[model samples]
Structures are given as structure tokens and as C-alpha cells.
Target: MKKLNFTSITKYTILFLIALLLTVTAIVFLEGRKSKNISLWITPASYFNEGWYYFDSDSRRQEIDSLPVRIPADKFGTARIYHKMVRSSHYCMYIDYYAHHQAVKAFFNDELIFEYAPPSNPGWLKSYRSFHNLIAIPLNRDGILCIETKASISSTAGEFGQIRIGSRDELLNRIVSERLPQFLLGAVLIVLGFILFIITAFYLRVAFDRTILYFTLLLIFLGVWQTEESRLLQFFIGFQALHWFFEYMMQPFILILSFLFIKELFINKKHPALIILFACITLSIFTQLILQITGIAQMTSTLFMINSMFIVVFAYILVLINLNFEFARKSVKVIFSISIALCIVSFIISSAVKHHKNFTDPILYLGIVFLFISISIFVIQKTQKQFNAVRSAEIYKKLAFLDISTGVSNQTAWYTLIENFSADGIKLDKYCMFMFDMNNLKTINDQYGHLEGDKAIRSFCECLKRAVGKSGDIYRIGGDEFICLCKNIDYTRATQIENMFDYYVKNQTESKVQFTAAHGYAFFSPSSKADFIQAQSMADKAMYENKILSKKGRS
Candidate 1:
């Protein structure tokens, strides 16, 4: 792994801050400029089509999916409707409307203004209705609007949702402003989930427990579910059965997934409640699916909320039990607190929306945003700790093996390395060993101080490194003694390496004291009778002889 530098970190930090600033600035701007929603006119049931009719055939009006909001119906034929109202003098500069599943031909004040035909496939709808316009009637006094929509079983289930008008720029701005945080937050959570998933499955592999994996999957489900619940999803899903599934099914699914995630996170022993909770949720989900699919049950947001609350209640009780667990980490406590808080807040908001029709709150999205942000911080901290631990272990291993005085492998490391190779069944014949002895080291230490002697030793080690390069491993075997092991090298090259070190020392000018060493080398082949122990003794004897010869030359 590559090391992170200050430059790179600073660059990334600056970039992230800039992006965050821009996003916040834009959000503030959108929030500051309030876009007041003004309903133009309500669709009233009518029997007349105003002399305009196309695709009046029965085959084109097959039932597919029900709408979220109710509109006046005509079960036998298309529900022909018209509305007469005055546009407010304070009308904003923009207009937005959602005539769910309606094939519309609209007119304002007896003048044909707009036209749109529903597609065969329901997928033509997207998450946002930026361009899906039913009509472009100019806001004026005494405006008369007409819409001919196909009918369904329910009163207003066929033509669903409301037609809203607001400022053009402000409407688009509000659309993004309201939904942006949820979209971005959900996207980020999804990415984090994928990262954790990959880490568990690939990077960490076998080490990590399944708790993290379950958490990752829970996050993914939450993100997708949250996105689906947002107003933005209306444009993406159109008016298909998928909309109901997302609104109803994903809620219970996330709740159940969270149960599993929590169980794995802190509970080593699965409580009976865990199995019962899972079985009940599983049964509810499948039962709901069967009923809805078979048309026996009509799914509604109220019923969905009830199911979600049931799971949430059980989850809270489980969390309360685990929060008191003696072995739980502080992180686990924090997560528990956060989950409970979010659950309480969400339940209140959901209940308020269900009972009180006029109530609206954007603060609900903040819970999701905060939850993921908290999880992201935890992930970063945990991953960083793991990385630091591995790096520290490597550093300690290096420290244990290194000779502190000369930065060469110490005797202990030398034996370990040899043993590892020998244990692997590699014979000494595959290696060439050169032993070195520093001549007159005790005399130098007596003449000068130990510091200068140490300097001389380090200088000799440096010279040896320059001579050997990457050809072999060097070890400070003992006091004033060193050894080099070169694998697959012949005696000739070992002799050349020894001479290079000797030449480098003789030509040295930077050091205050001259450094000299005597070396003797021996090559071992597979057929050789001498073991490594015997070869080391032979090398030491030859090195002492060389030292004696050098002493005579000095005389």
C-alpha cells in the first residue's frame, strides 16, 4: 500500500470542503427563497368531452396499477372532468402539476392549451416530473380546464396525485432543493455499503465477523428505500405497482434487515425474540405480497406505517436490552442511541403525517443523513485503526531484527533467515557466504572515543551496502564481525563483491578515520560435504589469516 502524504491529504480536504460549500450554498439559496404551493383548480366530475375524443377504444384503457391519490371515476368509460377557477393575482412565475396515470387534453377558457397521451409501458414515468407536463394553460381570470382520464375500481384511485402550480424557476429549484439531500445522502450510503461489502468479501476476507456485512446490506436497503419514499421517485416510477411496493415493502424489509444487523453486531447468542421477530416479519412480508398480488388487499400508506411501527417497537426493545450489555463497545452504545433516536423521531413524524393531513416536515431527511454520516465516521475510524495496527506490527518486526548500531540484520535475524530457508529444505549449496572482520577496531576505539569507532563501523557498513547493492543480504553477526549471504551467486562474483568493498574503503576520503576490513568467502553447492556450520568456521579461519597478513603489511 502507498503511504498517504500531507500534500495529497490537503488536496483532497480542500476539494471536499469546496464541494460541500457549494452544495450548502445552493441549498440555502433554495431554502431562503420560499416557493409557495398554490393549487390551481380541483378536478370535478363531468359527462361531456367538449367534442374532442381520440383512442376511445376499450383496448387502450386496460387496468394496470392504481394511483396514490384519488380522483373522480367512470368505470364504464373515461372519466371526463373540468374545473373553473381564477388564478390568484399573486401567482408565482412557475407552474407544476401531476395528473397521475391520466391521458389528458386540457383547454383554458375554451382555448386548447395542452395535450398528453399515456404510454403503453408504465416505465415511461421517472422520479421527477420536470418535463412531464399535462397542459400549459396561462394563469388568467375565469379559466376553465377539462381532463378526460380512464377510470378504475376506486373513486379517485384511477386519476391520482394533485396538480400544483408555483414559480417556474422556484418550482424546479424547490424540486431539487427538497430532494437533493435525500438523493445525495442515499447515494453516499449506498457507496459506503458497497465499500464495506467489498472489504468483508475481498479485502479483509476471513478476519471480519458477519456483523459488518449485515450492517452494509442494511445501509443499502435503507438508502434505496429512502430514495423510493421521496417525492423524487414519482417521476421515475410513474404510477406503476412498483411505487406501492417501494413505499410499503421496503419499509418492513429495512426494519427486518436492521434486526439481523443488530443481532450480529452485539448479540453472540441469538435470543428467542430474534427468531420470533424474524419469522413474524417474514410472514407479514410474504402475506402482504400475496394479498396485494392476488388483488385481495389494496395497499395503502396507513397500513404500511402500521407494519413499520410493529417492527420498530420490537427493534427498540431489543436495543434497550443490548445497550445494557457489559461487553458492548462505546461505539455500539452510540449506534444504539442513534438508532433509537431516529426510530422515535421517524415514528412521530410518520404518525403525525398519517393523522394530521396538513402537517409537513423536511427535518425527517436529516435523520437519514446523520445516521449515514455517523456510520461513515465509524467506518473510517475502524479501518484506520486496523491499518495502523498492521503497519505498527511491521515496524516492530523490523525493529526486532535490525542491528541498532549499524542498521544491518542482527545475529538473531541471521539465524532466523537461515532457519527459514533450511526448513524449506533448501541446502547450503544454493547459497554463498562471505564473512568479514574489521581490522584494528579495538585499537581505533582506544585511540579515539567509542563514538568515532561507531562512526567507522557505520561507514564500513555503508561501503558494504554500496558494494553489494541488491546482490545479497548483510548481517552484523557479532562484535567487529559481519556476514553476507548471496543466493545463486558463484565464488567468482562473491570475490568481486569482497574486492569492491575493500576498494571502496581504501579510496574513502569523507570520513575522519580510515576504515579497513578483511573478508573470506566460500561457495556451497548441493554436492558439497560441508554444512553451513562448518563453512562458517572455515570462513572465520580464512578471515583471521587475511587479518594477520594485513597486519604484517602494515609493519
Candidate 2:
């Protein structure tokens, strides 16, 4: 048997464990804080989940052990749920429940109290389909509470949610408070998405990848969907139609954005399966919209079809992951795979347990949060890697043209500038070139050491740079030899610069060794029509003459 190596696997396992621990810690901390806040002000409401009986339109009654019991898919007609309410001393008692795509009528002691039957139009029916119902119940009167629900479409049939009884204020508070964490989470995602959008637009545009843009969009849509699903917005907006429209419309977009994000994450490879998936989803969304507009079918009725499409999407993602397993980064592969698995499991569970519809699915929320976190990590890592690459390239380019020893443009940069000037057909008369050779550098090196020689050379270069400032460019072409190219300078300005350079060299006191340089400048005459090489020769010749004169004066 051959021995197997698990070194890479072990390393990634450790990383995944650490990441998981941190994520769990953060969730626990947030939940703990929420729990503490809830305890402070929220009063728990009594849920009437059991001891109920349901009757169909045919007058056939069936025993319901719990409040939330799914009616048969085939059953579509008027239905009634009867539960005896306990007499309460509270002056204002209220019963709250959620009705999905069903017209509701509430009665107490065979007397009608509340009705929510909307117009028969499909559009009107869709707008009123799903909502939180809060009915004021009479207090100090013992009577049977009858909730009559009617569902015309079979898809919307049999879905009932938990009923709660409490004071009106208490029940309202409970409803909002229960979904507050989810609402806030969604709001945070939306805010974060917009912030990322602004940053990418203004600051990171050059270095940003489309992957991050897609991720930002995913966050925004996901937040919108989550917030809408929480149904807390209905309380404030007071427009069930608008909320319902957004609730259904945002789903396909969220799915599309997710796919786009994943596609970009895989280096934008256009897989055939992915293309087909995109086309299919797009077609389905448009078809659903058309059906909704024509009143032929409602978006809610086609949810199973959408759910099936997503199942295909998740399956395709798994297949794609497997195909790219060897090439994907360890962190990305592990984190993304785990998150997708969690999301798929949660989605399946949420779909399977349809009867329990009191609050937004927390497990699905966790999976989504985890997936977003994983995407954030991947995108940030990729952006950081690209940033490092760009920074390194810039540093390399700068170092290529810089003289590390003298803090000046090096010989390579001088040649490059000359090439550029020649390529652009620059006239020699537009610029003046100066040649400089440091005096007594050999003697300084022989007497004081090479370090002293280097100091002298640097001192001379600094004097030249300060005198020239922004008006000219300086290059250290060789040891103790420098060149200055000044463009668009007149004779008077050139003289002033030369005088300044001499003054700076004379007054220099930073080094123990005296720093002096012999420099010669030549203005290119238009009459001579000289090339740069000839002009450089003229400057070099003048520099030698200046050196000889300086030596004679010293003697």
C-alpha cells in the first residue's frame, strides 16, 4: 500500500475551522445582544397552536391538532377553522395571524367581526394575497373564534400560519420585535452594498474586478428580498401591493446576480451549462411576468417551478465546483462549497416545512449570511492580490529608472528619456544640456575612503538638483559625472541656475570633505542644426576646458 499525503488538506481544514469558529462567535454575540434587548421590553404573546377544527365548503369537518396545518393541495374552496377563545379581562384583545393568498373572514359567537375580501380581479387578489392579519377580539365574552378562509387557486390552498392572542399593543410589538433581527440584518446588507458600490465607483475602479460589482449587487438584492420577506416593511409602508410586487420581483434578480457572481469568480469562463442556466432562468422570469400581467397565472402560483429551477441551479453549481476543484483556491473552494451546501440544505428544509410560516426562515438566513461572508472574503482576497501586483509593478518601474545610491535618475533613465525625445522629433534649440564632473573625487576616495567619495558625489548632485528645481531634469550617468537637461529656459534663467549651483556647492557643509564639480552648459543653436550626440560632445568638451581652468586657478 502506498502512503498518502494529507498536508494540504490538513492546512485548509485548520483554516476552515478557525473561520467557522469566528463566524459562530459573531452570530452568538449578535443573537445574545438581541435576546437581551428583547427581554428588556418585549412581552411574549400566547400562541393558540392546538385544539382547532377545520371545515371545508362541503360542510365536512376535520380535527386539526395544531394551528398551522396545510390543507390538501387538491382542496380549493372556502374553509373554516374553529377555536374557542378563553375569556380575558384585558380590555383590548387582538388575534394576529398570517394569511397567504387567501381571503379571510373572522367571526366570534356566530357574529361577523372582521372581513378582508378584496375585489375579484387577479391583480387585486395578488396584492391582497399575503399579509399579516390583526383582528380585534371582544373581551369578557366566551365564544368560538371562527376564521373562514377562501382560496380560489389550488397552489394557494391549505397554507395557514400560527395565531397569537394578546393585547393589541403587545401583539403588534411582538410581531415587529420577532422579525427585527432579520430586518436589521437585511438593512445592514443593503447599506453595506451601497457603500461598496460607492467605494468601487470612486476609489477602486481601476483595481476593482467585476466579481466584486456582481457581489455588491447580490448583497443589495438579497437584502431587499430578505427585508421584504420579513414583512416588517408592510407595517411602515402601508402598501401591501407594492410590498408583494417587490417580494416576488427581487427573487429572480437575486438568483441571477448570484449566478453572475459565481461566473465571475470562476475567472469568467463561459461554461455551456452556465449559459443554458442563465437563458432558462431569464426566460422563466419573463414568462412568469407575462403570465402575471395577463392574469393567466400569478407569480405565487408558479413558485414550485421557480423552486425546481433553483434546484437545478444548485446542482449545476455543485457540478461546476467539482469540475474546478483542482484549480480553485483552497480557501475559496472550502468556504464556498460549505456555504452552498448549507444554503441548499436550508432551502430544502424551508420548502419542505411549509406549514411553519410565522417568521422568516432563520436557517436560510444563516446560510445566506455565511455565503455572503465567504464571497466577501474571496473578493477581498482577489482585490488585495491585484492591488499587490499593481503596486509591485509600479515599484519595479520606479526602481528601474532610479539610482539607488545617489537619489537621482540613473543612466538607464537618461537613455530612455533621450530615446523618447528623439522619437518625438524634439528640436535641440528647445533645451540646454549641462555636463558635470566632480573635481578631486579620485583623491577624496584615495585619502578619506570610498564612502567619502560617495558623499561628495551625492552632495554635488543635490546642489545641481536644488539649482535646477522643476525647470530641468538631472541624471547620474556615471560615477562623478552628471548631466542636466533644461527645457524652455532662456539665457538669463540658465545663467542664474549655474550661479545658484556654484553658490550651493560652495556653501555645502553636511559632509567633512569639500564638494566641487566642473560643469559646462551648451545651448543648441538652430543654425548649427546639431543632433543630441553632437550637442553632448560640445558640452563634454566645454566641461574639460572648465576642469582645466579650475585646476590652473587652484594651483
Candidate 3:
């Protein structure tokens, strides 16, 4: 029967217990805070979507059956949307909507109430993509609500989104809840990126792979871009410029970093196609920034071009992967290819939805998340492979230098240690060399068996190890002989170790085989190979003399 390793079992048991305790605690905390009344927590808002009238720039009025009245893309001018307000007594009534690439003014009963991005501003200043608006309705009054909108961009003229009316707090809560997942996911990715960056930097000496750094950067940029896309930050910081800058700036770098990350998985580091793509994307980013800064063009105006570049690069990467399929790692070939393909499909879908509905879609973000997961899998696989290789190398190294029977350093290790010291010209200052010879090993083997002799040898080694402790290294140089080398030890310490060895050998009771050994030690300060050999010879001679004396006493 095999003996059980109680120490390992106990260690695992403790870890499992700790994990269970933490899980239970978390469950209890979550259950305690869980809300029972879901309806009360989430108040449904009413949509003021139907029965609206729209008047175009040509003074032509049209009765719209529903909200989100879309004007012609070729038309670039002011438009008016009219709807009758219904006062609600049960809630603090407010109307909330989104304005996209347009300036908006709200009037209640011919009185100006709320306005954003007045027509007096320059075209550049009014070029913000989207902003949310909330207007409170006066109590005890019923009047017609008119929203006047102006769009300088022809593509976005007269685009009105869904208008919702409800309690102010409920509407705000609903909006936040809708965007919270994307915001949290982005924040989590950013935090995870920072954590990975710190870990890679801390273990930079041991970790040779640069892919982790690239992947971390990619995560951070993806996070920033996703958060910006969520529009949750707009609620906290009203400045649209900051959000626009990050959203556009992070997109280009995300592409570059993703390319670099994929590039690292391949055997060939420098692929011409990838380099060209990288340079082109970088140039486009710089050009966009310069144009936007100079007021020659807005970043929003060039968004379609950037998105087109993304599609081109994504498709090109698929082709590139096909061309270099044989060069990439197996993990990369399967995971990266599928992830990129899925991302491309999702990007197309998301673009279509955004173009159709004039609103942000979550499909692209989901695809990005999937891509991140795949990249993480690839990195983990690579790291695991490297770890296994290093572990195998270390195991092989230990086997080469270890004695099978005695579990001590073998003769080869001793020779190697001496050669290393000699080659490095290291002086053995105040070093003690102890030699040990087992007694009655041949008698035991001849009378009982070699198995008993092996047991005796192991027993002798165990006692020697106990005596030596951490002060010296023990080596099994021969079948019945051993050597212990101690650094920075004097004659007095050598005598103490010798006494300890005898005491341990006499008191050893684990093995049924009777075991004894004769040992002798010599001090030396050798600076050369010859000097080390002379010192070893002296210790051996002293061990032989002690062996003979021990035999005579037994006689």
C-alpha cells in the first residue's frame, strides 16, 4: 500500500475550507442586500412617442404618427417637432431625450424652457455627436411642447430620437441602469489591465514575453473606448470634447496593439503587410488629430473613415492569418482567427444598427469582449507552455545531480561543485570537509540481502543529514562512502557536528536495520584544485583510520 501524504492533504483541506468560508460569506451578504420588490425598485417610464407633428425648413408641416421623425439626409436646416403635454400628478413629470449632432431648443406654451448648443455658436462648436436632455414640466399647467432642432451636418439633419416622459429620478435611474453594464465592464477591463501591467512589470526579470505588455495596453484602450461609447461618463463630466478625444484616440491604438499582439504569436515577427497596416492606421490617427485640432474637420466627421479602416484591417488580418497559418501557434491560429472573424461580423451588424437607428449598439462591445477572452486564452496557453518547459528542465537538472537511494547529492554533483569553484578561482576560506564510511554494509548484504544494505545506507544518510542540518551539503560519493562540505566552519564546529552525527546514528530508531558510520573531518582554505584534492585526501585518510579503529573496537 502507498503511504498517504498527510501534509499535502491537510494543506488542501485548509485551502478548501478557506474558500468555502469566503463563498458563504459573500452569499450571505448578497442575499441580505437583495431586493424583494423588483417593481418598486424599477419604475417603468412612459413613452411620449406617438401623435407628433414635424415642420421642415421649407415650412411644410407633416403629421407624424410616431416619434423619431427622420428628415432627409440632403436637408441641413432647422426643424420643429410639436407634441401636447399631459400633466401627471402621481410623479414629478419630466421629458428626456437625446440630441444627435444637432442644436436643440425646447419651448412650453411659447415660453423658452431648456436649450442646448444655441444656433449662435460656430458650426465646429455645434458638431458634438450626442447629448442627453431632461426638461421638467411645470406643475398644474397643460400646454404644447415644441422642440426646435438645427443640424449643420447634412447627414444628421432633423434626426429626433425617442422621447420618454416619467418621474425625473425614475428616468435617470432607468438610463443609468441601461448603461451600467457597459460602464462596469469597461471599468473592470481597465482595472484588470492595470493589474496585469503591474504583475508583468514586477516579474519582468522572469517573464521574457512582450505579448503580455501589448495585451495589457490593448485591454486598457478597449476599456476606455467602450466606456466612452457607453456615454455614461457624459452624465458625470459634461464636456463632450474629452469623451470624443478618448473614444477616437483609443480606437486606433486598440487596433495597433491588437495587431502587435497577433504579430507576436507568429514565428515571423516582422510581417510586411502588418507593418504597412500599422503605419497606415497610425498615419490616419495623426491626420485625424491634426485636422480636428486645426478645425479643418471634426473627428466625428471622419468616424466613418476610421470605421472603414477597421473593417479593412480586420478583413486583411483574416487573409494574413490564412497566408501565415503555418507560422502561427496552434492556439493563435484557431482562437485569434475565430475571434477576429466574429468581431468583424459584429462590427458590421453594430454599424448597420447604429446607422439605421441613430443610436449606439452593444453588439460591438460584446464582440470585443469575446476577442479579449480569446487573447487571454492564448496568452495563458503560451505562459503555461513556458512554465512546463522550465519545470521539466529543473526536474531533469535535479535528477542529474541527485542520488537515487540516499536522496542526497551524488558523486557527479560533488565533482561539478569542485570544478565550478576551481574554474571560478574561488577561495575555500575556513571550509570543513567531512568524510563518512558505513560499517558492516558487506556483512549485512551477504547475510540478509542487498535490500537491507540499502536500508542501512539510507538510514546512515538520514542521520548524517539530521546532524549536518543546513550548515553543510552532503554527497554520496561511493556505495558506502559519503562527503559533507561545510563553509565558514572552524575546528570547534566540526567537532560538534561529528558528535551530533554519532548521537543521531546511535538514537535512530525508524529503520529496523542496525546502522553505524565512522566519520573524520579536516579544515582547509584552498585556492586551487591541487590544494582542494590534498585537503580531501587528508579527510579520507582520517576517515579510513577511524574506520579501522571502529572495526577493532567491534572485534
Clashing pairs in 3: none
lDDT scores in order? 0.62, 0.76, 0.77
Distance from true location, Cα of 142 in model 3, Å: 3.7
TM match of model 2 to true structure: 0.67
- As a whole number from 0 to 100, the lDDT of residue 498 in candidate 3 is 91
| Model 2 clashes, total count | 1
What number of clashing residue pairs does each candidate have, in the order they appear?
12, 1, 0
Give the poorly placed runs of model 1, Cα more than 4 Å off.
1-80, 84-95, 99-144, 148-160, 166-174, 187-221, 227-257, 267-269, 298-339, 355-363, 373-392, 409-460, 466-500, 503-555
For candidate 2, the C-alpha RMSD (Å) to the true structure equals 10.5
Each prediction's TM-score versus the true structure: 0.58, 0.67, 0.68
lDDT by residue (1-555, candidate 3, tens digit) is 766699988998999999999999999889978766445445857788998886655777778878777854334567778887666564347788788767888888989988887343444444655777888766466778888888745556777888888888878887787778888889988998998777655653336577778888888988888787777888788766676567767777776776676677567567677677777777878887777667677777776667766776667756754664342367566777788788788777766666653343668776777667656665666566666676688889999999999899999999898887743345447788999988888988998799877888888999999999999999999999999999897778899999999998998876677777888978888786776688889999999899889889989
Worst 10 residues of 1 by lDDT: 44-53
Write down the lDDT that model 1 would get.
0.62
Give the runs in model 2 whose Cα sits over 4 Å from its true position. 1-38, 48-66, 69-89, 103-129, 138-154, 157-160, 191-206, 265-270, 318-332, 352-360, 408-454, 464-503, 509-555
- What's the CA error at residue 75 for candidate 1, in Å? 4.5
Task: Judge candidate 3 at residue 471 and give its lDDT.
Answer: 95
